[model samples]
Target: MDFFNILILAIVQGAAELLPVSSSAHVIVAEKLMGLDPTSPEMTMLLVMLHTGTMFAVIVYFWQAWRDTYFSSGHAFRSNARLIVVATAATGVVGLLLLKLIKHLVAGNDPGFEIEHLFANAKLMAAALAAAGVLIIASSRLPERANGALNLRTAAWVGAVQGLCLPFRGFSRSGATISTALALGSSRRRAEEFSFALAVVLTPAVIVKEAFRLYQSHALTVAKNGTSLLQLVGPSLVGMLLSFVAGLLALRWLSRWLEQGRWHFFGAYCLVAAVVVLLVG
Candidate 1:
C-alpha cells in the first residue's frame, strides 16, 4: 500500500473504531475498493497500528470521566472493578467459545483455516451489519430509564452480547454493548461511559492478537520482499498518527449524538451501509 491508501484506511479505521460501527467491516470494504489485500503483511501491520492509535484515543478522551466515575473513591473503585471483572469474564467466555466453534465447524479439517478468512465475506458482513443495526434501532426504542448504576446482571448481559460481536465482522462491539446496556435500563450516559471502559480494558488483548498475526505475516513477507521487519514501522506509525486524530473526532461525534438522543441515527446509517456493502460485494 502507498501513502494515499494508508492515509485513507487510517482515517476510516480511526473514525469507525469509535463510532459504534465496525471498523473491521468498513476497513475491509475500503481495502477491497482500494485493491489492497486485507490479509497482506503491510495492511495487517497498519491495522494493528491504527487500533493502537484508537485505543489511545479512547484513553485520552475518557481519562477525566473515568477518574470521576470509576476512581472517585474506594467504594466506587471496588464496585466498578467488580463490574468490569464480571463483564470481561463474560465476554471472554462467550467470545472464546464462539470463536472455537466457528473455527472447528467452518474450518472442518483444514488446519490452516482461520477466522481472518471470514473477514472478507460480503454476505456475512451484510448480515452481521443488519443484525447490529436492528439491535441498535430496537434497543434505542425501548422505554428509557434513569438507572445510572452498572450492576452485575447488566454487565453480564452486555458482555454476552459483546461476545457475539467477536466473530462477526460487521457486528459493532460498542454498538451492541451500549445498546444492550440501554435496553437493560442503564442511563445512556452511563452506558456510553461503561461501554468504552470495556473497550479500553479489552483492547490490549486484541492488539496482542493482531500483533501476532502481523508478525507471522512479516516472517513470510521478509523472505519474499527482502525487507526487514523494522521496515514496516514507518508506515504503521504514520497511519497510527492519522488514525489517532480521526479517532478523537469520532469519539466526540459519538458522544454528542448519543447524548442528544440521536443514537438510532447510526443504526439507520448502518442499514444503508449494509445495502451498499451487499451491492458492491
Candidate 2:
C-alpha cells in the first residue's frame, strides 16, 4: 500500500473501530475501492495492526473510567473478572460452534475452504450490517437500568451474542454486545465498559492469528513486492499510531453520544451504512 492509502485506511479503521459500526467492513470496502486485495497478507497484517492501534486507544481512553468502575475495590474486581470469564467463555463456545457450522454448511463440499473467503462477500456484509443496526436500535429504545453491573446470566447472554459476530465480518462486535447488554437491562455506561473490556481481552488473540496467517502466506507477497513482512512492520507501526489517534477521537464521540442518549443515532447510521455498502459493492 502507498502512504496515502495507508493513511486513509488508518483513519477509517480508527474512527469506526470503537463505535457500534463495523470497522472491518469499512476497511475492506475502502480497500476494494482503492483496488487493493483485502485478503492479501500485507493487507491482513495491516488490518490487525490497525486493530492494535484502536485497542490501545481503548485502554488510553478508558483507563480512568475502568479504574473507577472496575478496579474500585477487590470485591468489585473479582466480581467483574468472574463476569468477564463467563462472558468470554460463552463467546468462545458460541463463536466456535457458529464458525464450525458455517464452514460445514457453507463450504463442506469444498475441502479447501478458509473462513477468510467470506470476509469480502458484499451481500453477507450488508445483511450483517442490517442485523447489527436493528439490534442497536431495538436496544436503544429500551429504558436503561441504572447502576447495573454484569451478572452471570447477563454476561453469558452478552458473550453468546458476541460469539455470533465472530463468524460474520460485518457484524459489529461492540455494537452487538453493547446492544445485548442494554436489551438485557444494563445501563449504557456499564454496557460500554464491559464491551470494551471484552475487546481488550480478545485483541491479543486476533493479533496472533493475523500474524500467523501473514507468516503462512508470506511467499507470494514476498515475490511480488520483494519485501519481507518484517520490512512492512515499520510502516504498519506508523499506521498503528495514526489509527490510535483516530480511535481516541472516535471513542470521545461515541461516549458523548451514548451518554447523551443518542445511541440510536448510531443505529440509524448503521442502517444507512448497510445500504451504502450494498450499493457501493
Candidate 3:
C-alpha cells in the first residue's frame, strides 16, 4: 500500500475501532474503494497492524479503570474479578460455538472456510449493520440507571452479545455489547467500562489469531512492485501512533456523550452509513 492508503486505513481503523462503529466493515469498505484487494496476504497483515494500533489506544484509555477494578485488592475487586472471568468465559464459549456452527453450516458445504468469499454478499453485511444500528439506538433511548458496579447478570449478557458480534463483521462489537448491557439494566458508565475491559481481553486473541494465520501462509510477502513488510515499517509505525492518539480522543468524547444518553446519534450516523455503503460499496 502507498503512504496515502496506509494513512487512510490507519485513521479509519483508529476512529471506527473505538466508536460504536464496526472497524472491520469500514476498513473493508475503504480497501474496496481504494481498489485494494482485501484477500491479499499483505493486506491482511496491514489490517492486523491497524487493529494493534487501536488496541493500544483501548489499553491506554482504560488503564486507570482496569487498575482500580481488576488490579486493586479488596472485596469489591475480588467480586469484580470473578464476574469478569465468568463473563469472559461465557463470551469465549458462545463465540467459539457460533463460529463452529457457522463453519459447519456456511463453510462445511464448501472446501474453503474463506471469509473473503462471503465479502461479496453486501446484503448480509447491510443487515448486520442495520441490526447493530438499531440496537445502539435502542440502548441510547433507554434511560440511564443510577450508578452501580458490575453485576453477574449484566456481565453475562454483555459477554453473550459480544460473542454474537465475533463473526458478524458489520455488527459493531462495542455497540452490541454496550447496548446489551444497557438494555439489561446496567448503568451507562458501568456498561462502557465493562465493554472496554472485555475488549482488552478479547483483542489480543484476535491479533494473535490473525498473526498466526499470516505467518502460516507467509502472507506478508509483497510482489516486486508491491509494498514489502520492511518498506511498510515507517508508515505503519506512523499510522499506529496516529491511531493511538485518535483512539484516546474518541474514547474521551464518547464516554462523555454516553453519560448523557446521546448515543443514538451514532445509530443515526450508522443508518446513513449503511445507505452509503450499499450505494457506493
How many pairs collide in each candidate, listed in order?
0, 0, 0
Q: Mind giving the per-residue lDDT tens digits that candidate 1 earns over 39-94? A: 87887788889999999999999999999999999999999999988999999999
Could you estimate the TM-score for every candidate?
A: 0.97, 0.96, 0.91
Write the number of the candidate with greater TM-score, choosing between 1 and 3: 1
Winner by lDDT between candidate 3 and candidate 2: 2
The lDDT of each candidate is 0.90, 0.89, 0.80
Question: What are the per-model C-alpha RMSD values against the true structure?
Answer: 1.1, 1.4, 2.3
Instruction: State the TM-score for model 3.
Output: 0.91
Rank the candidate models, highest lDDT first: 1, 2, 3
- For residues 16-84, what per-residue lDDT tens digits would candidate 2 score against the true structure? 889889988898888889999877777878877998999999999999989997899999899999999
Candidate 2 residue 34 Cα shift, in angstroms, is 0.7
- Superposition error at 219 for model 3 (Å): 5.9
lDDT of 3: 0.80
